[model samples]
Target: MLADVQKALDAFGEREINRVFFVGCGGSSSIMYASKYVMDRESTSLASDLYSSNEFIHRNPRQLGPESLVILCSHYGKTPETVEAASFAREKGALTVSLTFDPDAPLAKASEYVIIYEDGKQGGTFANEAPAIMLELVLGLLSSKEGNTKLDELLPSLENLRGIIDGEKAKSLAAAKAFAEAYQDDKVIYTMGSGANYGIAYWFSICLLMEMQWIHSHALHAGEYFHGPFEILDEQVPVIQLVGLDETRPLEERSLEFTQRYGKRIIVIDAKEFDLEGVAPSLRGYLAPLVMQAVLRQYAEELATARNHPLTTRRYMWKVAY
Candidate 1:
């Protein structure tokens, strides 16, 4: 998939792609946030924007133009809003690329280029595939212009990610059991993370806890915790902190310390505990969110099991018209 994405990027060689848009919905949109975070930290010239599928179709940013590269993601490749956004971008003459599990789905057909992965083949998480492919393509494209050596070094680490993630399943599942038991009775929960992990926190809160389990959850950036969110922290409120190995670790640490002081039920899932074997040390920080996502998939499953609620038991998602 990476090789195919590389070829697609290569085909855009001589064009002046001034901006890049990562457009999707829900978990897919969170994946875009991870890619945008990487692009902001690594790319010197290209500007990256993240937009939800419906928002992209409705607001249509002025920066999206003929010289823009728009990448969209949909797990089943049939998200209506995302497919429409792809068609809209293509109609506007922007290059459209899609990452999905189904190559023949609407999103893939609407895109000029598509990277398809077999869902559930690698543990049923797009977290590993989408982020890695998009990061590689974005960095690979930027490397040609910025000459960043980190891109070259970092690209190789992706080769061993599957093995490392697979190896951590036991540990992740164990942690998940503990987490699910702790919060099974709770009606609401709050989650916090900084930097790239913020998107992971958001994804887990909205997609898993809220949408799947029918629990109320809020995801807050660690840096913004003290401003207003901290007031809600109490002995009874459950707070889950996702700590990553990035520069923003200290921010999450601060939030963790405060949560520990004020909140009795504090669950900390630190990516630092995972040994990302064969992954480059320098790139681990950037890849921490993807690692955490893989780990949290175990948590989501355990939580659903403990609560006796199947993750697919949605009240309104697909049962009725929204």
Candidate 2:
């Protein structure tokens, strides 16, 4: 799949690509944030932006033309808005690439370059997931445009992601169970992180906690903790702080310091705790969020079990038209 991603980028040519747009919705939209963050930090000449599929179409940036690359994603590739976004991008003369599990999906048909990721329902490893694929695309762009060598070092680690993620998930189970036992009755859960991990916090808050578990939640940026959100903190509030190994570590640490003073029920999922045996030190920052995500999955699983509400339970998601 990485080879396919590279081939797509190579065919597009670095000289022809000046801007990038990532478009999706819900969890798909959340997962692309890390890539956009990486691109923003690493690429000097390239411009990148992320948007929900509908918004991408609605805003219709004037820069959406021949020199632009639009990457869209959908788990099953049938998301109506995402498919429409793909077609919209194509109509605007931008090179359109898409990541999806279904090759025959509407999104795939709508894209010019389609990368089919492994379906999680079919035992796909984290290496083959959307985030990993998108990260590789971002690395590919960096390598082609800015001469980044990190991708070469990161590829081997990405290959070993399955074992690393499994080990971390195993280590996280005890903590997840403990969290489930302690915070089961809490009505609203708060998630916080900075840099790349913010997307994981966002996904956990919306997709797992609120959407799946029927709990109210909000994702707070660690950098914005002191602005207004910290006023809501108290010993009774349940806050999950995701600390990643990125440049934004200090921001999370700062928030953690303040959070520890007032919030008694804080669950810290720090990436530093994971050994990440084979992963290179240079790539840890880029890969930490995926590790954090795997750990959060265990928390969601245990919490759903503790609440006796299966994660698959949904009231108005697929049942009613929004």
Worst 10 residues of 1 by lDDT: 119-128
TM-scores, each model vs. reference = 0.95, 0.97
Model 2 scores a C-alpha lDDT of 0.89
Model 1 spans > 4 angstroms off: 120-128
Please report how far candidate 2 places residue 231 from its true position, in Å: 0.2
- lDDT tens digits, residue span 1-322, model 1: 3566776667567667889998999999986776787788888898888889899888989878899999999999988999999999999989888899887898988998898755547464332377787777777777766776766766668777776787777767787899899889899988899887888999989999999998999998899998998999889999889999887899999999999988899988898888876778887878878878888888889999999999999888878986
Pairs that collide in candidate 1 are: none
- Tens-digit lDDT track of model 2 for 1-322: 4566877768655448999999999899988989988997888899999999999999999899988899999988999999999999999889999999899999999999999887455654666778888888888788887788777887788888888888898888999999999998989999999898888999999999999999999999998889999999999999999999998999999999899988898999999999887888888888999889888999999999999999999999889998
